[model samples]
Target: MSRQKTESEVARTTGRLGPAERADNWRRLGSEEFDVVVIGGGVTGAGTALDAATRGLRVALVEARDLASGTSSRSSKLFHGGLRYLEQLEFSLVREALRERELMLTRLAPHLVKPVSFLYPLTHRFWERPYTAAGLFLYDTMGGARSVPGQKHLSRAGALRMVPALKRNALIGGIRYYDAQADDARHTMTVARTAARYGAVVMNSSQVTGFLREADRIAGVRVRDVETGEETEVRAQAVINATGVWTDELQRLSGGRGRFRVRASKGVHIVVPRDRIVAESGMILRTEKSVLFVIPWGNHWIVGTTDTDWNLDLAHPAATKADIDYILEHVNTVLATPLKHDDIEGVYAGLRPLLAGESEETSKLSREHAVARVAPGLVAIAGGKYTTYRVMAADAVDAISGDVAGRMAPSITDRVPLLGADGYHALVNQADQLAAEHGLHPYRIRHLLDRYGSEIHDVLALGDERPELLKPIPAAPNYLQAEVAYACSHEGALHLEDVLTRRTRISIEYAHRGIDCAEPVARLMAEVLGWDDARVAREIEVYTQRVDAERDSQLQPDDQAADAKRSAAPEAREKLTEPIS
Candidate 1:
């Protein structure tokens, strides 16, 4: 005979990542011997941890900074087959990514990943349609079965109806196709939390200083808590490095040259109000360099991506005036109303970890990933795009088979839905009831359902005692006060930057860029983390300086000047140091 679970019990059993959980995981890290230890808290690392844990392996994961703090959070936020890659004739890469996209849409993470449509504006008149149709045909069928709609061809007038913001001369016709997109930071953190639910010890703000070696073979890692400078040795039979752009840097710490090298390709994006572009669907246009995207974000349009090589400052890849100008110049050619600098609300830059090749152009590099056993017990995986993270993770863990003691199970992450995935559709169906119960609008309830899924109950439970938390933030009304508290209580947010930048995306969505609400957000976090008044003030000051530095960097003309300006801000994790050999 079983009893029904209380609301509090349900929240407790769902793997809350609070401060107590971190303290317990730290003790286990110092005390236990594991089958595998993964470094890097990006999507691949989080995915690798989930893959390892579900296979019944004892596993632990550690990140130097906040999860997705580096490249993962600063992405184009799409999970689709790289349509541009088809022009490069990378068929297998497209097929693999499409399959992953279908899985995320239909079976796994249905809450986080949603189907989005894009219009490929046809500049050429006659031959271009058939040529593009041929490519689209291959794209639609290559993924086997999909949940999204197939391609539809439209006349020039039809295209204008779909996107009235487009210039009359921009295209003769257009083709609309379906893809998927998600909040990348939220998805990556959910992957990590799902790993924790499956019994993988996970912690952020912990850096790998040096490799632990047993004679010639690698044994484990020496981890330092970047917040407190506490050191621990997490022993493991195998170690996997899934660091993206920093792959080579982490490989060097192992004192071994990796099987291949990784080069950093910088990509920059800018955000503007959604009303600036009067479109029913997103647009994809061609450039001499690469494809330009006008992605539809909530109340905003995300336009971007200049692909150029970047060598300086892997941690904070800065966007210069040239990069922003390049994007605006290309996108403005197609828009009816040209976008200027003043229309821009936010800017961000991220690096793609491409496998070093003979070509000097970063856009020419392969999108396929590579996994190699760099040392006896060490494996390194790099050079993959965001959509195919699960495949990259599986290949990485499979590379370390010999290091583990017993026969390891094959990767089961494809069948494993993320933490908030289950029961999401059912809750979405109950949005009206939820809104009535919580005294919120149905739109707000639907938003919470998308972000939290079935775990919306856990998030709402935080407001039970303090109903004031249910109200929206004064400046950033898109987010609730409960969400900020939930960042620390259930998402392992350590500092103010983690909440504004990655956890909730308040930084990039608003014109003030999280500066106006930094103190209020910090105060909300302090309630859960037990911070003093001085500590709250310090968090606000650090976050404000970061926003100021980013604004200053965007005015710089070149990468060197932009990097210097951006790097001047104090790191949130003050004790974090360079990787020691």
Candidate 2:
């Protein structure tokens, strides 16, 4: 049985991904024949790396940019089984997702994934309540409820009491059911860190430039450092592509026909202050096209999302005026005080890699993932929700297990816990003691514990010699000054955008959209990244332009105009162009 971690053990847990790890991994990539080389640093790729490493396999994961800087981070942040998928009779998919959700909540990521309640309003009079109750009953009992509470039926008045923001006539009644949520970016980062802990060489800002061909079969990959422009050939027994929306694009780079195609469906979200919603639980409403979720985030409510076809730039999906207005108008239909443009604090858009099918509606596309060997030594996985990333990763690795080495172990991620998960519950009980020791508020210490778990001490150690690092940031007061430095020194943050956008939610959590604290954050990051005055100024300029471009894109009436405006901003690095098919 496992026991609580000692201070020395916690200190040496060493998922510390500083500049040294990057440099060392970069050197080691070319020197060894890795058992498996996983592409993409998103949740699936990271999870795959973790699974492979934990099974005594030599693994290396490469990302062209920062971890979860793509669809992974921009998801709805839910660990819930798809309630809507039940309507389509996708029982196996729902059951699989629910099982994974239970694992995340109770065993794997107790510190990160927490149970959240959602109010499903009944708009229709008679059969709606019974029908929804039946569905929620299945949802609650599908896999098992070892963590979150089951569904509870409530009257309209009771529902309004749960969510005071709902209008009087918004519903006849409602059923509040439990689901889990997490900071997708943080979860993905922790997965990468856990992989590192298990001896996986995980590095971001390393892009695969081309595939290495061994005559009639596949061999390895040639990759380039997006930071230093250094090229290296990493010989691996097999490679798994978990590039999400870029799945089709990466398949093209291999010069082969993938088993299937992936279609990009753009989903946009707007952030409003929590006080604006005045809700005890999140709200889920049905829209003509899809569904809208007014999710409860800390100190803010996240309203989203618009599902539509996107044919433009996949890297930076833009939220158009139509998308924003659509979300607002739909969510406003039941609001006690309808949200306005002024209430909007931030906006973001992400592309979902839905499996291309006969269904014209992107919302109807299957979230059930598919894995196939596009060529010898190459496996491609795509089309799954963020909640089921582990299953997807396990499947992807299993596809190549036979070819890579002899008698590989079966997927054991079901029993594996992420870094900081082991000692998390104990630390939560010691929040007050931790606060006193660290000279922080109990609430603040608790917050840090949730974010870092047992790794809180490691982060707190950084401020031991520098007291000023413990203070909160001026512009975005929710985050501390040390987080900026820590993002670089320990989180593989290479640019200012990496820190603001994904490392933290500041970019989309505030009205200023991290503009006020951009310079201070840049300065803090510069201290760790060794950015000169010129580089700092340039970093600030690029981030500011990106924000401006997003703002400009949101004013446009349609997708084409918005895409053009969003694409006008320069990329931080020269991303590899998709090879001609």
Candidate 3:
């Protein structure tokens, strides 16, 4: 019988199939060719891997770093149809995105994605309100907007009543529209895990050093185990390049004429205390080239993102001074009480892998993606928004149908619920009873459900066994100690950063940046990963330096100056030994 995959089963499988297993498998790749080998474990790559595997293809997905470590995780956390795309007359894009959004919320990832309301404040007296209202009316009638509440128009007095933080003068009136929000990092990781569950041999920290070729035809790849610095050849029938901004680098490694240029646009976001921005719904403000969103995260407000062209380090893009200033200036215009540098609790920067169209403005460049068969055995897909990743993956997989030689199943991802999605509503209904049994407040259980969905029982499993793990973490009380331990043991979190930054939001949610809780969290992780005191200290030090560098960058005068400062910080050191071939 195929064994049911439990939490422990998942952990054991991942630990056993780490870097060493990666190397051994790579060495045998050419001898036992995979049906498809996917490079880049971002959302698109992960989604693509799942699509191919579900269709009965033998697939292997490799990433140089963590999954969703790139643009996928750094989004505005919205699964939205670009309402602004309508202004540019991109009706088709918005309709498709809206349909996908509806699918995700109602059927696919119901556990992870939820509806969020946004207030579009009209500034001008006469023309703007009617204009904005007409657009929103269209938005409501479009594909799946009906899944959410329809638009609500409010007068200036009514607008201020809804969003008391806004100055009365800022808006002539307002219109509320519906969209969906997601935990981007969590969703991306779940996508990768879903792909793994479907039989994709998903491995991270396995870097592709070069492409494998059989004469003129491209074949597979020469991959390095980033942990051990060992290399092996992973041969496949067809390879897909979904490396986002690293597409050019992958092409150079492949030694081919690269298909299309990918230009990186840097977007920076600042997080402040929730009390600072008093709004019932999120706000969207227009900018010169793009738009800025003051999105509400739990207990915090996320105000960002300045969009400008970037030519900096792809792995860790730094927010320049200009980026920060631009955001502050635009946001300040609408706020009754302005936010200063110290008022900011956290800052983050991400790069958008936009297809470098001939347009001078990056914002005007199409968000639509392109899939190109660059070589006989290779295909590369790039340039799309996160909301439409599934469609993009399906398209990329469809491109390789000729080479696969078998009748393949249609894309089932739209119908395949993520791991936690099934039975989520039923679990939600029983959360109160579960919370009382577990000695947690009902709110806590609800919180766990939102983050873990039905898999919350797995998290609670550790607590049930060890009552001590049920207590709140010392410095970061929002998280339970069991959560910290679970991340390392189950989520492939090798280092403290992975646990703090990705697995949990302590790095961004707290002003201390988890410094006070680092050692305790490290200790909790140590029990599972076998880290000693010295190792724990080193991890803490590395994380502290990273936080310090980010803080220093935020103080710089402009993007150039901020990037220089941020880049001065040491590069991330390897935590595990590279694989041995």
State each model's CA lDDT, in order: 0.91, 0.88, 0.81
User: Residue 497 of candidate 1: its Cα lDDT?
Assistant: 94
- Lowest-lDDT window of 10 residues in candidate 1? 6-15
Per-residue lDDT of candidate 1, residues 1-581 (tens digit): 99997432333356567888888888889999999999999999999999998999998999999999988999999998887789889998998999899889988899999988999999987799999999999888896237888899999999999999999999999999989899999999999988888888888999999999999999999999988899999999999998888889999988999999999999999999999999999989889977889999989999988999999989999999999999999999999999999999999999999999747888888989999999999999999899999999999999999999889899999899998899999998999999898888999999998898898998888778888989998799999999999989889899999999998988999999998899889999988999999999999999999999999999999999999999999988899898621
Worst 10 residues of 3 by lDDT: 572-581
Report the number of the highest-TM-score candidate. 1
Ranking the candidates on TM-score from highest down gives 1, 2, 3
Error of 2 at 257 (Å): 1.1
- Per-residue lDDT for 435-482 in model 3, tens only? 999999998888888887877887898987799998999889888998
Q: Which pairs clash (backbone N, Cα, C closer than 3 Å) in model 1?
A: none
Provide the TM-score for each candidate, comma-separated: 0.97, 0.96, 0.94
Q: Best lDDT goes to which candidate?
A: 1
Q: What is the lDDT, from 0 to 100, of the residue 451 in candidate 3?
A: 84
